[model samples]
Target: MSKGLKTLLAGAALLLVWGALAAYTAQMSLPSLGGGIAYDPLFVPQLLIGAGIVLAIILMVQGIRPLLAGIRIADEEPQKTGRILFVIVAVGLYFAAMPVLGFPLSSAVFLLVFAFALGYRKPVGLVATAILGPLVIWYVFTAGLEAPLPAWPSF
Candidate 1:
């Protein structure tokens, strides 16, 4: 299959999954805080799902345009299946390690290792990103969003 067709298929699948998730989240009952503290537990989830839906639609549009124009969008190069598997395993390990190592630490390690895997050889940029990326995300969650994140190892 052409890359555009694959993209369209993936987007369609994502749209279906996101639609299902939106439906499920919509069924979540809001807890009554009663003090006029207007809080919706599903707000963030709904926002994210909405964004995902938009992105899926955009992907579908982009993918279909070339096909409609009678253009064969060829893959730039053959994809490396082994690299894809490696990334999948790495992501699984990152998730498994998060509770033990904490989000910031686990994320930093994952970013560092993944950057190396992708042939990012600049020492300063690698170090900076490994250190700063998780820190920024942690701050955004913990401070900006008023959400708590695990910053230290559980053990």
Candidate 2:
């Protein structure tokens, strides 16, 4: 009906479709061995992913806010478009560098680029933030969750 509601409903439909696919994949997959432990897709991570998709679909259907609101229009749409393009390029470069330089290095470069673009004067501070943010995320994901990242050469 309303714009926001319509958007949310569309998102919900997508989520449901994704979840159904996940469920089907999990059900059809055979157990795979990982680190001497066999992983069955019907449980754990795949199930969790499916649950998340279901939740998203439910939220979209519910439409938490009443009105369907469109994206806020920029006073000058060209500037907004430029910014979006820049962000896509920055993120693309970061991912491209990930396999070669690894996550830490690529993330650092991204942060630095973002800082400079946003008018940060101190190169030192930008470097620090870039380095530290990725390191922290790496620590949390790897150490905390015990999920190792994608390595360059299958180490």
Identify the candidate with maximal lDDT: 1
lDDT (Cα, tens digit) per residue for candidate 1, span 98-119: 9889999999999999989989
Worst 10 residues of 1 by lDDT: 32-41
**Candidates' lDDT values, in order?**
0.89, 0.71
Worst 10 residues of 2 by lDDT: 69-78
lDDT tens digits, residue span 1-155, model 2: 45556657777777877777776775685656655434644556666776778788677855645443434323332356787888888888877777777777677777888779968979788877998888998889889999886533332
Candidate number achieving the greatest TM-score relative to the actual structure: 1
Q: Give the residue spans of candidate 1 off by over 4 A.
A: 1-77
Where in model 2 is the C-alpha error above 4 Å?
A: 1-78, 151-155
Model 1: per-residue Cα lDDT at residue 62 = 82
TM for every model, in the order presented, reads 0.51, 0.44
